[model samples]
Target: MSDSAVSTSRALFERASVVTPGGVNSPVRAFNAVGGTPRFIRSAQGAWLTDADGHDYVDLICSWGPMLLGHAHPEVTAAVQAAVGRGTSYGTPTEPEVLLAEEIVGRTPVEQVRFVSSGTEATMSAIRLARGFTGRDVVVKFAGCYHGHVDSLLASAGSGLATFAVPGTPGVPASSTALTLVLPYNDRAAVEQVFAEHGDRIACLITEAAAGNMGVVPPDPGFNGFLAETCRTHGALFVTDEVMTGFRASSRGYWGIDGAQEGWVPDLMTFGKVMGGGFPAAAFGGRAEVMGHLSPQGPVYQAGTLSGNPIATTAGLTTLRLATDEVYDHIGGVAETLKTAAAEALTRAGVPHVVQSAGTMFSVFFTDPAHGPVRNFEDASRTDSTAYAAYFHAMLDAGVYLPPSAYEAWFVSAAHDDRAVQTVLDALPAASQAAAAAQGGAR
Candidate 1:
């Protein structure tokens, strides 16, 4: 199939629109923010995606963060296959889950973990545990720091919802979101003020250890430390939602990077994405006492029939084992290469831009120093998104796939090597030109 042969995807999408909401299982897949038909992906390997139209593009979105080792890695595929032969869903305890949990704890050394089905489930359960342990009702989150679509956490979501400009999903009751206190990212004083007012009623203050949902916004110096101390002083649990940054950010993830340096650790941390190796597995863990508040051990209740599904566990274990020190170094190198290339391209085009990054995750914002640095969601909202959309389509047309929205981070996997880097670089000139042309259209 070629892009011209629209029979398969177009026909499928047309039929799907009537049955599924917006013709996509996920809203971002509709490409509404990017203003074009989405290339339906059929298969992926290494750093490339083959679309249903038979077009091949070097993938930078990396399946929204899980493909840190790239799609269909041999070791992961083999492990999943072996587990499948044993059985898909045991609905019982499995050794792989234990091994995966051991690997996570061994790496982070912060707490005991419980595996769940998705990042949403992990955050949902973690919030419930925090509430149960603290005997409180309020949860604090930052604007533009998405922790998945759990009803309470979507007050100021950043990813797909931000991309599409959907105010809030229609189904969630307004009262359900009333308890969520949304604040600006990287504002310590604001956080302190909120804690001063509502700390007693607040069960937890959750944030992306590094905010990837809003284009790789790293913590300001001493920011994570302030959060840790504030939470402790106020008797609120500090929960780091590392679903996108978990293993992909570093061997131990963003918390290990910032928390260790600051001599602080969150009371609870959630993990997903790269840890699952593209499978639907996630976990939340922290101090044993805090985690103990969850289920059979305490009053908070969370259970899933597929909580530790064998196949997902096997995939997770294989990916975690493969992400050795060398793998991290390789991913870091690739990220640097991409960042340098993008910066050079933007500079040469005389485009005012800011490249925000952490480990292998990065995003390019079409704004200058006059914006006073994108410290929070309000600053991030000032980016030239229409320019980004044009750049995205140009890159896609030139055989490189970036995240469709300006708000989302572009991920670099260990599998993206010299060839992938060169491919993106080759596409940059045209993408830059397109971005410059579209700059005035940004709102």
Candidate 2:
């Protein structure tokens, strides 16, 4: 049984805080947004995380959307074991990189792919390549679309709709964001205005294929296609960051559901998460013409020492091969079931909420239905963080772990069998009640 005391977790957190910046490697994991002692997971397997206190909970985060087959998947583990038997990173190109790259090229619109160690590198490299290919200085992005922590991309929307962005964080200098134009997500007019004014200087307009960072605010129907068309019209590259969605949001990522149907292809796409198969592998790729401009072939250069580590690539390859139709079907059904149940629970508890999804990835907003359909960062900001914190703790107490913040996607895996699903479903009523209680007189 799970304990509310969390005494051991508290102690470990205290110890870790002395060494680590915030007692966690990632800011979100610190529970700063949720207001509680974050559970330190000792291990995970088959849709369950065993915390340091030996309490097991249903894992809804799924390592921020990578473990589609679920934690400690047998086949993936076996592949990695075999790979480790050979050796770890060699700093030299290996067979697994070739195989994994081939798999990526087959699955997406990317014509040629270059491996990287993380989503950040993939985005940073893609942007550089875009600038190089266009010989332009400006880059456009949308609010709520997180494309990793690249210096230029770490920017907030400026004072006006068509203005250049200001630094969103303290460390980012104004000069870093000087050339970035940040606009609202789903606002086509804003996009058109920015391009109309700065199209010649704009190298690329990058956005998440679906905005999962702001709790899965999916691109409006025909939205991504619109971006592609606009960029094409201006000779600017259209770059879609699929770091959170690739493979997790359908076999080929969110692009599979949207771009494939719309018949538009991005000039560049950055991928991570599911492609890494829970490892640190990531990549960026695009049409042959654009990709040819990257390193050895042309001028834009990007390299990583552990870009395609054999163990990581082997694990990613195995996971991708195993991510079949059945895997997606299972995850989608589970997501639908859970989202429906949570809606019902929230309704019963008198807590107005809206649930949004991007393929299999989804998030429940602690906002009213009337003000919903969160189309941009401002709309996403209306999500009641205080209510979410209460709900998060309530769910944690009930043995279903959600994302530490409201502004994040919930993931499910083929391994989320009946037992794990039941645990979450069982927890929803109480969680909704907590949210309702916390949101008193506000909604």
Give me the candidate number with maximum TM-score: 2
Candidate 2 regions off by >4 Å? Answer: 1-4, 440-443
Which candidate number would show the highest lDDT if scored against the true structure? 2
* Residues 219-327, model 1: lDDT tens digits: 8988988998999999999999999989888888986688877789889999998878898999999999988887788878899999989988889899999998998
- Backbone clash count for every predicted candidate, in the order shown: 0, 0
Per-residue C-alpha lDDT of model 2 across residues 76-123, encoded as one tens digit per residue: 999999999999978888999999999999999888999999999999
lDDT of candidate 2 at residue 187, scale 0 to 100: 92
Superposition error at 32 for model 2 (Å): 0.7
- The C-alpha stretches of model 1 lying farther than 4 A from their native spots are 1-7, 156-167
The C-alpha local distance difference test score for the whole of candidate 1 amounts to 0.85
**Model 2 poorest ten-residue lDDT run:** 1-10
